[model samples]
Target chain A: MGGVITGVDLLATAVFAVSGALAAAEERNDILGFILFGTITGIGGGTLRDLLLGADSVFWLYQNEYLWVCLGASLATWFLAPQFNSLQKLLLWADAVGMALFSVLGAVKAIQLGAPAVVAIGMGVMSATFGSLIRDTFLNRTPVLLAPEIYVTAAMVGAVSYTLLAFFEVVEAIALPLAILFGFGLRACAIIFDLRLPKYGDGR
Target chain B: MGGVITGVDLLATAVFAVSGALAAAEERNDILGFILFGTITGIGGGTLRDLLLGADSVFWLYQNEYLWVCLGASLATWFLAPQFNSLQKLLLWADAVGMALFSVLGAVKAIQLGAPAVVAIGMGVMSATFGSLIRDTFLNRTPVLLAPEIYVTAAMVGAVSYTLLAFFEVVEAIALPLAILFGFGLRACAIIFDLRLPKYGDGR
Candidate 1:
């Protein structure tokens, strides 16, 4: 179980790092910018969650593998972005998987830490989305959280489902996969159908 | 001495909150946006510092007063912004003071936690400037840190000086005020003289 979770975590981090590198490329930033963007995007969400939960040590400070993955993903993106016309589509699917897993994992951590269910759910959503938020912010773009997209909503649903399942004493192996699938399915539907939340005041 | 530090901390938080509210106003955000911006700006930097230092509890989490101050400042700005033509200038001065004090205080916290001097100085700079960076990101504006302005340079100088002073066994009373004054003086000069860092590539 631990091995599976760690694998998913690294995959998520790598996917997010690639997205960040792409953003840096779009902005014509140098290699330093690509690394900076990639590192933050890979780690920012979990870092924020750890800080909020008062973890003993931030996850990446001790485990250097995460940093290496981010760096590798960034360099790969920088060198290969020009040839990858379908990269955006690939990224969207990978991001959906990442978001699903992160939301469940974040909520699980918060629950273990004795955070209230609501706060745990909030942490889950934050963990699933904050990396992208930080990435977009640093790129001087409006964050996806502020958009009417179904992104955070998908994470929220996953988090809420996991918290409820845990409250019912559901087994970890079953609950984790179920919750992630639920979130990813929702996100996939949103992507395929171009679904969005209602805008403010009849689309103004 | 503790009371004095607490007072300065609250004042800095309030000042930063007001700056955030003003930013919300500039963007024509509603009252909720004002509160969100204000609260994050007031607490973001300290939160980041505490997380990095592995503090047992985030400062604002234990003290409800900080949240109140942020809320009050946001409400005040929402109501009073329309009538204040000089609010921008007032905010600039207040932000300078806040930045100066935060840089010193953040370094003090890091040193007390036994962080290495270089990391302590980094914490100080992060504590002073991250709130504004978060705000600018949310506002979709180029962060002040990314600009050619001398904003971060002032904070860096203040943090470095404080760390160095502490290393030399300077007393808190003398070291604190002097570091802040040096930082604030430099910021004031930048504001007055339109000082800027050299842009990339000899002005393109």
Candidate 2:
């Protein structure tokens, strides 16, 4: 990867790490828990994705910067936690943005690894959801993905759309942003309209 | 690995999986939870160790038989859960057996990957502890390793012993059993005499 693209990835990862720490804080966990949550949330999904792809090494292990980024993000959040608790909705937007970026990136990575289409789809979901799932486990709570929300579905939309673009021979730059936008837009729209999936009690 | 070695590994893994499923059952969780706990507790530690050492693809993914072992062990425990729960004291012996074997195996794998001693130490502990940590996470219980009960210390002892034997060019057939004996002995001692690290709250 080039220097500029790597820089962008770093900033995006910081956002995800902060979201993770914030989630731990919401549960009133301690400092070690916050750091653990931040690191897992930041790198957990990508680690699984890379392992499956047979990439050189898990990205964070090769690059020390990611560790520092997660640690810094965790500490910063710890310091500013009291003030930010009031703006919970704002944190949701940050999480959505990170999810969009990660979800598309996952699909792109799987394509790069030459996995079959369905495997790519699975990788995409793994990339977007594994971290939060791990974080929830540590907090002893059910994962948001398993709880029936606009979670994995949003990533599926992102991955499927991205795969279609690649199928159509779109430019890398164009396809990446398009997938991110589609994922984020759908998630945002769902939140704004409270669009939840119908459950057992709902009429067919 | 040779056929005989592979057979022994599978047998040990089956015993460990049975212990994990029984642990979950004792907690009174459902069948799905039992399977989840059994599988993760059985394989996750080794997978983590492999990833860290950059070993070949995880053992479970390549070998369908390993998955079947975990599934079978989980099912068997789920059905006869009450019978096994009475054997909790004995089940701890099974865990110790798994930890001992896994620690030496992990160190050997790390050496194969050309990792240094510290990395190998990390791998050994990871192999012994990762699954139980994952299991505890799902059960919303604090991890036993985190309790500082000389658990990882015992794994490290076995790992370092294995490393020294490998360095001295000792035969693996002799060295591995010695390492396993060392670890299992430590754990059995800890459990039998109720030995634990002193805590500040214990009025020391």
Tens-digit per-residue lDDT, B1-204, candidate 2: 456456756766776787778678768878987787888888877778667546557888879898898899889877776654365664577777877777777787777666666556545755776666676766667655444355766777778888888788888788778877887788778777766654212331
> What pairs collide in candidate 2?
none
Please tell me which predicted candidate would have the highest DockQ against the true structure.
1
> In model 2 chain B, which range of ten residues has the least summed lDDT?
B195-204
On a 0 to 100 scale, what is the lDDT of residue A150 in model 2? 79
TM-score of chain B of 1: 0.92
Question: What is each predicted model's overall lDDT from 0 to 1?
Answer: 0.80, 0.72
Give the 10-residue window scoring lowest on summed lDDT in candidate 1 chain A: A195-204
Every model's DockQ: 0.16, 0.12
Residue A115 CA displacement from its true place in model 1, Å: 4.1
